[model samples]
Target: QQQVKQSPQSLIVQKGGISIINCAYENTAFDYFPWYQQFPGKGPALLIAIRPDVSEKKEGRFTISFNKSAKQFSLHIMDSQPGDSATYFCAASMSSGYSTLTFGKGTMLLVSP
Candidate 1:
């Protein structure tokens, strides 16, 4: 079964705008949620992540907002740029000593100038 669900199969944003992506999970066992960014012909790279212990986490222009009770999370990109155009994925996994990620369907973001 798909553990995570992501919305807005595609998004378009202008330069300097903000882009948002959202995801939700039904499994309470998921303790780690991470968002990944992937460009063409490349593997997904970890962008931002959050543990249920924290409500939010931020790194530079990337931010992750987590809601444990609701089993939801979202990613925000500040100052969206053309270079930021890529496919984004939200993933969930248990920190059960093994590193395995179940990813949601990707969202393709286009940041145009």
Candidate 2:
């Protein structure tokens, strides 16, 4: 119950379009949900996050929609741009103490001009 599986290992979208990626988890003990964005060899950075107490969270161009009962979450990029091209990872962690994050396989987003 520690796995978070993501899909569409890669994605291609045009500028100004929407980019979507989905992920699911098995651990009910996980209470913190976060989406991270990585460029090249750099470590993933927290782009946005949600808790089991919330259904959704948004920041700038990034949005995370969460379903508590289904144990699923998704990232939605609005008005995606070529600069948005990067690897996106969905992760889960516990709210208490120092818990290692469980990351999804990752989704490579390619926004072509």
Candidate 3:
């Protein structure tokens, strides 16, 4: 079974609008939650991350909201720009594991100009 589940396979937003993507994971052992942004023909890069210790995190226009008890998390992009159009992925990982990331099916965000 997929460890993580993501919704809204695709999304479109107007310029300066907020884009939201959500995810839920099955494994309670997961200690870290991270969001990645990937552009076509390029690799996914880390966008934002949150630990179970915190409820939320933000960097620039990207924000990650995490819920420990619910085993769920979401990404919110504020004031999204056209350049922000890309695939976003939510992932879970544990330091004790193989050190590999378990990613949710990605969300494709299209930010219109």
The candidate that wins on TM-score is 1
Per-residue alpha-carbon lDDT of candidate 3 for residues 1-113, written as tens digits (9 for 90 to 100) = 99999988999999999999999999888898889999999999988898889998989988888888898999999999999999999999996748789999999999999
How high is each candidate's TM-score? Answer: 0.97, 0.95, 0.96
List clashing residue pairs in candidate 3: none
RMSD of 2: 1.2
Clashing pairs in 2: none
- TM-score (C-alpha) between model 2 and the true structure: 0.95
> All candidates: CA RMSD in angstroms?
0.8, 1.2, 0.9
Against the reference, the lDDT scores of all candidates come to: 0.94, 0.93, 0.92
Candidate closest to the true structure, highest lDDT: 1
Q: So what's the TM-score on candidate 3?
A: 0.96
Point out the higher-scoring one by lDDT: 1 or 2.
1
Give the per-residue lDDT of model 1 (tens digit) for 26-105. Answer: 88988999999999999999888889999999999999999888889999999999999999999999988887898999
Higher-lDDT candidate of 2 and 3: 2
